[model samples]
Target: MEKAAEFYTLEKGILALKDQIDALAETDDLDKKDRIAALRSEIEKEWARIVPQLTTVNIVQIARHPKRPYTLDYIAFLFQDFMEMHGDRRFADDPAIVAGLAFYKGRTVAVIGHQKGRTTRARIDRNFGQANPEGYRKALRVMLEAEKFGFPVITLIDTPGAYPGIGAEERGQAEAIAFNLKTISILKTPIINVVIGEGGSGGGLGIGFGDQTLMLEHSFYSVISPEGCAAILWKDQNAFEQAAENLGIRAATLLGFGIVDKIIPEPPGGAHIDPEQTFKNVDKHLYQALKKFEGKPVDELLDERYKKIRKLGVFEER
Candidate 1:
């Protein structure tokens, strides 16, 4: 995990100012008020200049920040009565993937996501959030059940990639992910997918097929990681910073490609800076997105989904 000081070098001075602000908040000094106001103005000016000009690599750093809210965090903040389900019926469960039924705004919904842990022990247990074939299968199982119960499906995508170990291949990893894509496309219930962090390769997409796809401001979705792309194309992993720019992995870039429907704004510095506000922003968008399908018939919903999928990557032949 990259430290904030290391990854956000450009913001080091700003961060120092924030530390002073933190100190000020703890004191009952009337003398500090004017100084705090001036410090805040300086910080605001720096932010206004830097936030919009963040480099692609800066975005990659923010998306992978250790302090950023993960899928389970969002579940706790944005939903209620979450009853977690475990295991893929055909095999053992994978801790990297989480699926369950939850209540959102008084409506029952099925929530599934890639879960990377905060602590070392938990991260190892979750395999660093890299799902195996069984994880995807378990997600599909819960999704299928959600369809039966007429519940909307919400997927939070954040993965480096699917597990590529020999054991995973032996268990039909490719087949499992492909199966999810097919079934999710045709699922009769409303599905909304949010790319909350590193959406890398098929690991992200296996549970990412949704009628309405959203991405967080600093998050990215790509066919491969920048480091992987650099290694394959340039034979040097050091070229990842350049690779990130070439890959066009930003939320705004993907939105222009018609790959994602909405870009949910994060806190000014990043989601990790103010997670509660980010949760509120995400919750607002989720409710609005689900409401769009409230009265649509199953056939109409499926038809529209088909058309949306078909239109993706449609290009003019010159």
Candidate 2:
């Protein structure tokens, strides 16, 4: 197996901080300001220490962080009252892919995204943030509604990939994924997508189709993951470090390559380390992207999307 990249996770920092904080608390003679300052300084130091070294593999871990924000978490924090809309209108509701109409940035916007769970039981419950065929269908269903109603769409991409089970395939996984790209091609309302975590494969693309796309600094977007890529190319999963570097999945590389339109700077370490600060940065980027697309024509939006995607790879002379 590929070595888990060496990096401090948010949980680790939090746990370490807790120990120090508890020890400080037990010392009743300490001044309140001194204790608080010491705790904050420790966190800031750790956050600064780890920011520069976050790799694609380390991002994978953070994207799957048990406490990292999810679709519902953001909805609760960022939106007004949210009314969840469920079902693909054919099968059943999919918790893995949640959709809803919410009031955001002073207007109604449709939001959808993959939600990883905090525990093993919850991961199984949400299918490890991997959507099924029906999940994609449900997202498109909500997006189309947003289009018809002229509500802007906001999609948070956090899926490792769409489900690859027999049922998902039988339900037309490839077709469902294609249908998303096709439907969003002509959407009149603006679409904003953010790769908050692992934007893996078609599942990521299912909601990744948008007029403007932004990604977190530590987020990753790739056609396939490092492990899968390593397994395929070198037939050795242990080559993950090489696989991650070669995949060019980091936001900086992806933006340089034109695969992503904008990159939102994350909090010092990662989203998990300072969730509030991460969301703050994300909020700023969201409004900036949304305002820029506010008055653009559908034709221009399509052209921009096509141009951005078409020029995604290198085109130098051999």
In model 1, how many backbone clashes occur? 0
Clashing pairs in 2: none
- Over 1-318, each residue of candidate 2 has an lDDT whose tens digit, in order, gives 123324443347755775676677777764956885788787778777766666667877776665677777777878887899989998877788889899986899898888888788998999998888888889989998998898889999998889889988888989988998888777778899999888998889988967778998878898898888999998998887788888878888877876788998876556766677778888889989989887688788778867666666666897
Poorest 10 consecutive residues by lDDT, candidate 1: 1-10
lDDT against the true structure, each candidate: 0.91, 0.81
TM-score of each: 0.93, 0.89
- Count of clashes, each model: 0, 0
Worst 10 residues of 2 by lDDT: 1-10
Residue by residue across 1-318, what tens digits does model 1's lDDT show?
343455678767777887898899899988788988898788778778888778898888888888899999999999999999999999899999999999999999999999999998999999989999999999999999999999999999999999989989999999999999999999999999999999988999999977899999999998999989999999998898889999999999989978999999986577886688899999999899999986679999999899888888856888
In model 2, what is the error at residue 96, expressed in angstroms?
1.3
